[model samples]
Target: MNIQLLANVIGHEKGKKILINAFQNNKLSHSYILSGPKGIGKYLLAVEFSKTLLNNKSRQASPDLMVIQSTTENKKHSSININEIQELESFLRFTSANNSYRIGIVDGVEYMNYSAANALLKILEEPGNKTIIF
Candidate 1:
């Protein structure tokens, strides 16, 4: 969890800033919707965030860290569908793995279908201390 690592991965001052803030504050949103055009570090930041969660080396990474990309694998340009949101509903419905916080990084949130968006809204409506960002 060095600044160099973040710089290399995120390649931006803002990412470093956000990481520093969250890490220092000891608080990070459970859910973060990384939205942006393709190849502009949204995915990079998401990946970095996942790394942080993996080692619990930063405030962002916790035992409940989970990343939901737009597609599973071998697929490109597919938006996040309704089933993904429903799956999140189920994931959120459960308790944390280690009684720690749960984080869901829903990339490309804008691409979610109407049903998915609504489902996400419902989940957001009752965050219950779960952090959500878009």
Candidate 2:
């Protein structure tokens, strides 16, 4: 897919071009961080990339894609905990059932606590054939 054309954008043409070029050249890294101001569609971009990579019509139904988000408790800001990271680790244990690439999207990664970050770091240290977008 021509992601640069398929995905809608508002500014950040340079960043979009970089991602599209990486996809076209088969040079995407094992892990990446999409950090910027809020309401800039980072989540949407991640989902689009995941769908394109997995060739899934519905991002939620894709077996090869996992989208992780931070949790909240008592109306207060909470963090992504170690349990979530462990779940991601378990998800990574299996290969893509559809022969497509396995992808993990960690939304709002800055909300991850120290332990969770450490767990994710361990996963990144030996990413195997999986791709993670933070």
Candidate 3:
């Protein structure tokens, strides 16, 4: 995929440049927080950036990327939990085929339960070489 083209579509060239430069220099922070109003492309940027970072052209087919979001079941909204967080940690342990980036994107993290928030905190405290965006 042409990342430059994608970046133009998003119209966040400055932000994208900073991220790309940091990524190229191996100086990216362990975590990132992107907060804004709905429909402002925060999620889109995360997904696209993740795909680029992981060197995967197709967003759906990227094994190096995991997106965590809220779900609804039995008419009740579900939030992130310990199991999910544990799975994320486990996913990080696996090495990429060519040592690509391992990325996790937590969407709507405000919906996480108390335990899940704590778990996420613990993960953030020790991010290893993986990249997580909240």
Give the residue spans of candidate 2 off by over 4 A. Answer: 73-77
- Pick by TM-score: 1 or 3, better one: 3
Candidate 2's TM-score? 0.85
lDDT of 3 by residue, 1-134 (tens): 34663563466566677777877787888888877775678777888887767667653668777778766332244477778888888877687656877788887776777888888888888886765654
Top TM-score hit: 2
What is the lDDT of every predicted structure here? 0.62, 0.75, 0.73
**For candidate 1, what is the TM-score?**
0.68
lDDT of 3 at 21: 80
lDDT of 1 by residue, 25-131 (tens): 87765555555566688766765655554445555645465556665433443478778877766776667666555556777665666787888888887774544
**RMSD, model 3, all Cα superposed?**
3.0
* Residue pairs of candidate 1 with colliding backbone atoms: 53-61
Off by over 4 Å in 1: 1-7, 30-33, 54-63, 71-78, 128-134
lDDT sort, best first: 2, 3, 1
TM-score to true structure, per model: 0.68, 0.85, 0.82
